[model samples]
Target: MTSVSLVAPGDAPLTLPVAAAPAPARVPTARRYLMCEPRHFAVEYRINPWMDPEQPVDVELAVRQWRELKGVYEALGHRVDVVEPAPGLPDMVFAANSGTVVGGRVLGSRFRAPQRAPEAEHFRRWFEANGYPGVVMPERINEAEGDFTWTGRYLLAGTGFRTDPAAHAEAQEALGVPVVSLRLVDPRYYHLDTALFVLAEDLVAYYPQAFSPGSREVLAGLFPDAVLADERDAACLGLNAVSDGRNVVLPLEARGLAAEVERRGFTAVPVDISELRKSGGGPKCCTLEIRD
Candidate 1:
């Protein structure tokens, strides 16, 4: 497997301030991936074959997909973080947002939706195994892992959808991180990531339709150079792109968005995640990046 460099013009080399820092390299261009061995959601929402189904998915096939994803990551020399699937909470296995790592501490999340409650158990085990300190969960409030977005100084939590208003307040008060609450009302846009993602310290890509006036203002304030994705492409999960400081992984259908990402001096790799999307997930939904 040949490794592709993501370095682009005007991109500064990354450096760690301290000696004992985790890997400072951003998302590797050679690394592209998806999650295959997913647990099934309840039968109630089984309309999408990629989602919870009236029948269970073939376990063997799921395992094969997992191996494929792992193989791609491993081939690219990127370590794969695997979370054991939790029974009953079918979506629990989508481990990316189980928690957020900041200042070398892992804060496990409390999901707002009941169907995903089982995620806490799986996340707890993963955190413990990874040796992270000081995990916190809101006592009475419901907060989804998808709701929280963290930068060095601030953490913004989205309210509405699965995460509640009360949880947003709790995240700020309990976590000791300055929290800004963004409201998302559209049912299609279930999480903040569905419409917005921070590309860099000063850059973000998002769709305005999913954001409240206040939320857009907050984004504009925090990232002055934020770019808006076209609605057609945004519907195809264009705004959900992930950046590792070098390359971005975007939905395969978003060609225009991919060009824009490349225009910004980042390499854009289109990946097929149709299987994961059937279950209301994407590339970001599949894996957790443990920075340390």
Candidate 2:
């Protein structure tokens, strides 16, 4: 047999073991989000306790902060889609209240307060125009993601505030998911997203004082290892967070909550949206997850 040269002619020839190529790195799927620009965002009307028409809102600052928030998501390799902001709808920037998108269907919200009533039509039109699989107009008063969120298994619905108890049944039928109703007793935690947040599969972070005793028990049973937020952070809307399993986007002032999240193996991304908070919204309020 002729000897084969493993090197160039006149160069030293050596034998070497052939190695197998390493497998390609697995890339994680990017999460999709829906956001609205704070063009006409201001405290024009008093809806939630956080909103005060007398308190002036720096419109320009709010816009800049909102843009920064959108940039945060884009930098993390997540897709961000925008919905056109309506001129007179000051609260339109809080897109979370628009509706709940799950399994390709959009269950539109019906506002309990007339100040936000006009927002329902705009959101419904957007979903219909986008050709969602299905768009259900809720008959009962529901604040969409403001009071409803998915925990990978069940949809936790909040009531005794902006959302009506009757809407729980409507959400179940409309979204085709099991609904767990939780009562919000405190005015500050009027929206469910403000008091409770689902961080990952079977993991959550919440403020116990926001919920009634019964609701607190329910949450404890459902999420035993829930990260409890202290009164300071909770007051700063620390529980109002958006998590994509590994990364959690929350308020910059929520240092305590961020620490808790870091301990649980999640990267805490703090974004300052204090301008938006004046209107009763934070990072989560500005983001609406598109499950489809």
Summarize candidate 1's per-residue lDDT along 1-292 as a digit string, tens digits: 2233455589965543444433233443333222325644333454222355555445445445445555545654666766666566666546655766555556667765566666776676666766664666656445344667665467767766766777767676655678778888666677777777766655678887788888888878887777778888878876665665556767789888888777676777677665556566666666555544
Model 2 off-target regions past 4 Å? 1-29
Across 41-109, the per-residue lDDT of candidate 2 in tens digits comes to 878887778888899899999999999999999999999989999898988998899889888878998
In candidate 2 the C-alpha lDDT for residue 106 amounts to: 88
Each model's TM-score, in the order given?
0.76, 0.89
| Residue 97 C-alpha lDDT in model 2 | 93
Give candidate 1 misplaced runs (Cα > 4 Å).
1-36, 39-77, 140-144
Clashes (candidate 1): 1
Output the lDDT of residue 142, model 2: 90
